[model samples]
Target: MMRAADLPGVIPVFPLPGALLLPRARLPLHLFEPRYLAMLDDVLKTPHRLIGMVQPDPNPRAAQEDAPPPLHSIGCAGRVTQFSETEDGRYMITLAGISRFRVTEEVGGFCPYRRVKPSWEGFDRDLARSEKDTGFKRESFLDLLSRYFQAKSLDTDWETLKEADDEMLINSLSMLLSFDPEEKQALLEAPSLSTRRETLVTLIEYALRGGDDHGLLQ
Candidate 1:
C-alpha cells in the first residue's frame, strides 16, 4: 500500500485511448515509439519507475488541435514490474497498477512526453481491497459473457475464468473486452468495485442486445 506522500507528485503519462489499467491489475506494454521509449529510459533511472496510463478525449475538436489530444481527468499509475530490452531496441514491459489519480494541472513544455501533478486524495480506496461484501451476479455475468464470446468468436478457458475471484473477473473482463474508449474510461472512473461491476454488467448487456458497433470485435 502506498501512502499519499509516497506517491509521485508528477508522473509521465502514456495517453493511449481505450487502453485501461486498474489498480492491482497488470498491463503489458510494448514501448516502441521514440517518445515512449525515451519515457521508459527516464523512468528506469528514477526510484519510482511509475507511468500514468490515461486516455485521450475522443472529441473531434480536441483531436484537431495542434497540441496533444486532451486527456481525461483520471488515470491509473503503474509501476514497471517487468522490463526487458529487445535486440531491436524496443522495450517489453509489464506495469503493475498502483493507484488512480486525477490530473490537477499539466506541467508542459519540459519533457517530450506529458507530465502532470496528480491528486490521489479522492482515490485512497484504490490502495486497499473493497471490504463491502457487494455481491456479484456471477452466473448471470458468466452467461452473458459466454454469449458475448460466441458473438465475437473469441476463445477463452472457461475453467480458468470460473476460478478467478470476483475482483479479478470484473477487472479482467473490463480490460479484455473490446469496449469503446469512452466506455473503458467510464470503467476506470467508476467510484467503487461494485459500481464498476455493475457498469460492466450493463455494458455487456448492451452489447448482447446489439446496441453499438463499437462493442463488436475491433
Candidate 2:
C-alpha cells in the first residue's frame, strides 16, 4: 500500500561496493555486521521499512584508511519485504526494489549507519510495476548471454531465464552478475529498461573479449 510519496526524503544507505538493486527486483542480503544489524532494526520500525543500496567510490585511490569511502551519488531504495533472525544473532532480509534515488546529501545522525537525503526525481516510471521494452529481442539477447556464460563457465537455470519477463531478466542479471562496480553503476543509472539491457550486453561482451584485467566481477 506504499506510494512514492510514502517513501522518505532521507533513508539509510548500505554502501556495498558492487551490489545493485533495480526497480521491482528483489535483492537478498545477509546482515551480520553490527552497524547493519542496527540499521535493520531501525528500518523495521518505519512504515516504509526501506534501505538504500549504494556503491562506495568507484576509485579505490580516493578512499583513506579506516574512513568510509565516499559514496556514488545514485542508488536504489528498496522496501524490506522479508525478514528473519537466526539463533546466532544474524539477520536475513530481502529488499524489494521500489525506486532509484539520487543522494542529495548525507544526513548527520546519531545512528551508526549512514543516512542520506534521497531525491526521487526522474524515476516516476519505476513506481509503475510493469515497464515494457518492445524493442527487446529475447532470442538475440539470450544468444549473447549464453555466450557470456559459456565463456565464463557459469551455469544458470535456462528455464527460469526463459520464464521471467524482460525487466526481471535484465535487472536480475545486472544486479547478480560480477561485473566491476563501475559497470554495475552504469546499469543502475541506465535511464530505462532498454538502456539497462544494452549496457548489460556491452559489459558481458567486453568481459568475454577480455576487456580489462579488472575494468569491471564484477
Candidate 3:
C-alpha cells in the first residue's frame, strides 16, 4: 500500500506516445536510448526506484521544436520491479504500477531526462483495488477483441486471458491495444476503473466496425 506522502515530490518522466500505463498494471520497457538508459541508471541507485510514464503531446508543432515536447498532464508512476542488462548494452526492465498522478509542474535541471512535481492527492483511490465489478460488458468486449485480433492477424492465448481478473483483463487489453496517442491518454486519465472499461469497449467496437483509426486522435 502506497500513501500519498510516500510518493516523491519530484520524479523522472518518460514521455512516449501511444504507450499507456495504468495503476496496478505492468509495463515492460526496452531501454536502449541513451537518455532513458541514464534515467534508469539513476533510478536504480536511488531508494525509490520509481519512474513516471507519460505521453507526449500529439501536435505536430511540438515535435518540430528543439525543446522537449509537451506532455499530457496525467501519468502513472511505477516501481522498477525487474531489470536485466543485455549483452548489447540494452536494458530490459519491468515496471509495476503504483499510482496515477497529475503533473503540477516541470522542473528544469541539467539532467538529460525530464522531471516533474507530481500531485497524487486526487488520485489516492488508485492505491486501492479497483471495484470488483467494473460493470464492463465482458462478453461483448471479448467478442470485439476477438474480431479485432483476427482483423490484425494477432494471436493470443485465450486460456490465459480467461484466467485474468476483471481489473487485469481491462488494464491488459487497454495497454496491449494499438490505440492512437490521444486515445491512450484518455484511458490513462479516466476518472475511474469503470469509466476506463467503458472507454476501452467503445474503442474496440469502433475498431471492429472498420472505423478510420486516424479519426481517433481527433
Candidate 4:
C-alpha cells in the first residue's frame, strides 16, 4: 500500500547474481552475509523498503570480492513484501517487483552493501494496458526456442511450457535463456510486455540464424 510518489526514490541495495527481477514479478532471497543481513534490517524499518536486483558478472573470483559489481544503469525496484528471520541469523525475504528504476547516484556508509537514489518516472504503467500477443512473432519465437533446445539436446518440459501464461512464458524464457548481460538488460528495460516479447523473438531468431555463434543453447 505504499504510494509511488512518496517513495524516497532511494534505498539500500542487495546484489545477487543470476537474478532477473521484472515489474510484477516476485523474487525470494536468502539473506546471509552480514552486509545483506543488515540491509534486511534497515529495509524492515524503512518507509520505502525497496531493493535493486542486479546480477554480478560471470566470474567466481569476482563474485567472492567484497564489492558489488558496477551495476547496469537500469534495474527493477522491488519492495520487501515478505520477511522472516531464521534461528541461525539468516533472512528469508520476498520482494514484489514494483517498477523499473535508474540509478541516479550511490550513497555510501549505510552498510557494506550500497544504496542508490532511483528515478521511477515510468515504473509500472504498463499494468494499466492489456497485453496483446503479437501473433506470428510469438509463435515463431517459441518455435525457435524449441528448435534451439532440440538442436542442443537440452531437456525441458514442453508440455508444461505449452500451458504457461504469456507473462510466465516470456519472463521465464528471458530468465532461463543464456543471454548476455547487455541483452538481458535490454529485456529488463523494455517498456512493455509486448516490447519484451518482440525483443525475445528477435533474440531467438538471431540465435536460430547462428548470429550469436556461441554456446547459448548448450
Winning candidate number (TM-score):
2
lDDT of 1 by residue, 58-117 (tens): 666656547777888899999999999999999999998889999988888768889999
- As for lDDT, the candidate ahead, 1 or 2, is 2
Candidate 2 achieves a global lDDT of: 0.89
Output the lDDT of residue 98, model 1.
Answer: 88
RMSD of each: 2.6, 2.2, 1.9, 4.7
Which digits, one per residue and each the tens of the lDDT, describe model 4 over residues 122-204?
66473333354555355666678888887667789888877877777887778677777667777887887788887888777
Taking the tens digit of each residue's C-alpha lDDT, what string does model 3 give over 1-218?
A: 67666789999999988888888889999999999999999999987788999998767764655777888788999999999999999999999899988898899979989999998888877888664644767777678788889998999998888778888998888898888888888788878778888888878888878877767636
Taking all chains together, each candidate's TM-score versus the true structure is 0.92, 0.93, 0.92, 0.76
Error of 1 at 168 (Å): 0.7
TM-score of 4: 0.76
User: What's the lDDT for candidate 4?
Assistant: 0.72
Task: Please report the candidate that would top lDDT against the real structure.
Answer: 2
